[model samples]
Target: MQKLATFIRGDLVYDGSLVSDATLQERFQSSIDPEVVASPPLLGPKGIPQFRKLDFTRDPRLAGVQNPTLVLWGTEDKVNRPSGARSLQRRMPNCDVHLFSKTGHWVQWERADEFNAMVVAFLAEDSADALDFRRV
Candidate 1:
């Protein structure tokens, strides 16, 4: 548990310059699954093989997606770089990209309010557009 917490604190979460220890712990605890903590397959040899296989550069399906999409990324994320978001925007015809300045891999946890608001707004806009199209 300590090792996982340390990794989350040091690597997975924000850059440690802006977030408070208490807030980080609270967010971590809230998001942590006890079962996952007990048996972490994500760290095992079979863990995240799909991630290793992911080659966005060669993925032709990205350009085929037609639905409205939103790609939210954290600028401080060490696991997945911000360039991925831009790449998705360039490939997807109807995609919007939003980057959180000081957040990390856990953008939803790190910027809960802002993330929630953006998601809600995106959905609302999509819904409205669909309704307009139906009426037309």
Candidate 2:
């Protein structure tokens, strides 16, 4: 992601709240936030069971994904790092990745225009009224 950001001349917002590190453990144990009614990790370790079940580092790239793929990544996303999106694009032959700044986990909702624009353009390219993408 760092290399890609440099190449694309874009920004990468890092969220310190990611649970990847020991810091998350401390945060989760503290229960400082009033929103958390229970003893942190509302869903427990099973909350992210599938992710825990996989060996993501050694996961193989997909096959027959020749169609254009659109990836909308949130810059401040804690669950899935921005680098994951870059890696996904690297494997896919035709993928357009738009990293929305100041957004965490929900890029589409955070930056609607950019997200709409990317998807619209991709869809419009296959349509006769490609120019009407802005209206979409």
Candidate 3:
């Protein structure tokens, strides 16, 4: 986990999950769109391998890239703690880490406004300065 966290590719923070958040655990258990469990149609049509590929358990390093990175972690995230964010930050060549005290792994969803603002601000600043990642 630590290796993947440090070696990955794009904008990401190393928000660590010390443990599972009670709420996130509950929600994940009762998630509306759970993907791990196979549904008959998808399984039958695509096969087990394809269905498993839908999982988002990619290498963490993929998220630890050298792009203009912003690491946002909910201090309260049981599953993904501040350490996770830090770990990713260490991997990123350039990074900004933001910790929201009362939030969790679902920080983007829980703190939509702040997240949006930060993203917008980051983008605006990048555009104004013409920081283009596409060229390199």
Candidate 4:
């Protein structure tokens, strides 16, 4: 935990300068609990090994998705690039992308209020659209 925390604090914008060390530490600590550690992580060694091998980026099925989608991303997210969001929007015809400035991979945690509001609005809009389609 120490090494991973040190590395992230030094390399990322989500470092102590943008986000506090205490907050990062708390989140990091929570994930390292005995129960979580013992469990086979989805993306890790113990879980489904095939998950790591498959590249969703090139998956043709993405274009087949017809549902209205809201894709949220952080402008500063190092793990998932913002361009990925744009690609999703392009591939998924009914997709909308929203980028959060000065946020990292943890956009939900970093921009909780704005994230929640946007999600609620998206859901409401989708629901209204469904109702309209039904009426037609």
Candidate 5:
């Protein structure tokens, strides 16, 4: 549990810096919660191999998606590369891509106000609008 908490807190911030102290405290508190710490392991033997076999690039079904999509990504994210966003935008007919600079994997948590505003605006839109590419 301690190792998991450390990993999560460490991953929340970018290299050589930390998230707000309040956020860190909140993370710690949440980490120690019985419910939060009691979740089942993610990488059981069967699941581990299944996850390793999953590759979106090899799938052609992405191009068939007809719904309007919003792709939000962080330039500094270590988990998923920004190129994934670009690739999705290219494949999806109506996709808006927003890349946040200096942000890690936790875009919604790190930039709550901006993220919420973008989501609200996207949800309110009625038609398939032009691709809105912006760096926040």
Candidate 6:
């Protein structure tokens, strides 16, 4: 539990500069939910092996996706870099990428209003033609 809290309060916050104590507490609590505490999906011994087997870089399935896709990322994300989002944009047929500056893994939580607005706008769009990669 202490280890999980440390990882959530430190490694997940992207330099731990922008997050508040309240936000950290909330994140930590959510991470340790009773249902997920000892679940295989959690980042435990069982989950680590599954994650290690994933090879997104050489995956050909991403190029086959024909649906319109939105890839939202944080510029300061420590877990996954901005380049991963760019890679997804390149692979997906119709994809738009947005990078939030000064944000970490919890981009939606940190910028809820803007994230909600973007998601609403994306869903409201009449056509995929209206969507394009424009960093905001």
Please list the C-alpha lDDT of all candidates, in the order they appear: 0.80, 0.60, 0.60, 0.77, 0.71, 0.73
**Which candidate has the top score in TM-score?**
4
Better of 2 and 5 by lDDT: 5
What does candidate 1's lDDT look like per residue over 18-134, in tens digits?
556676577567557797677665442344666555646347788999999998899988877878888888999999999999888989878989999999999999999999999
RMSD of each: 3.7, 11.3, 11.6, 3.6, 6.7, 6.1
Query: Model 4: residues >4 Å from true position, as ranges?
Result: 7-15, 44-54
Superposition TM-score, candidate 4 onto the true structure: 0.75
Lowest-sum lDDT 10-residue window in model 4: 7-16
Which residue runs of candidate 1 sit more than 4 Å off their true CA positions? 15-52, 56-58
Q: How far off is residue 20 in model 2, in Å?
A: 28
- What lDDT does candidate 4 reach at residue 34? 90
- Candidate 3's error at 51, in angstroms? 19
Clashing residue pairs, backbone N/CA/C < 3 A, model 1: none
Itemize residue pairs with steric clashes in candidate 4. none
What TM-score does candidate 5 reach? 0.67
Q: Per-residue CA lDDT of candidate 3, range 1-136, in tens?
A: 3333332211122243423355445444553444545542233228777754543333456455766877778876655446767766666768888998767666776677999999899989878667565555
Which is superior by TM-score, 1 or 4?
4
| Deviation in Å, model 3, residue 90 alpha carbon | 1.2
Residue 95 C-alpha lDDT in model 2 = 70
Clashing pairs in 5: none
TM-score, one value per model: 0.74, 0.51, 0.51, 0.75, 0.67, 0.71
TM-score of 2: 0.51
Q: State residue 126's C-alpha deviation in candidate 6, in Å.
A: 5.7
| Model 6 Cα lDDT, one tens digit per residue, 1-136 | 5575576556565556565667667767776789767673634235655665563634678889887788888888877777888888888888899999877777787777999999988887725444443422
Kindly list the per-residue Cα lDDT of model 4 for residues 1-136, writing each as its tens digit: 6666655654344543665668778868878889988983655344565644554554678899999999988898777677888878878868889999887777787788999999999999999999999999
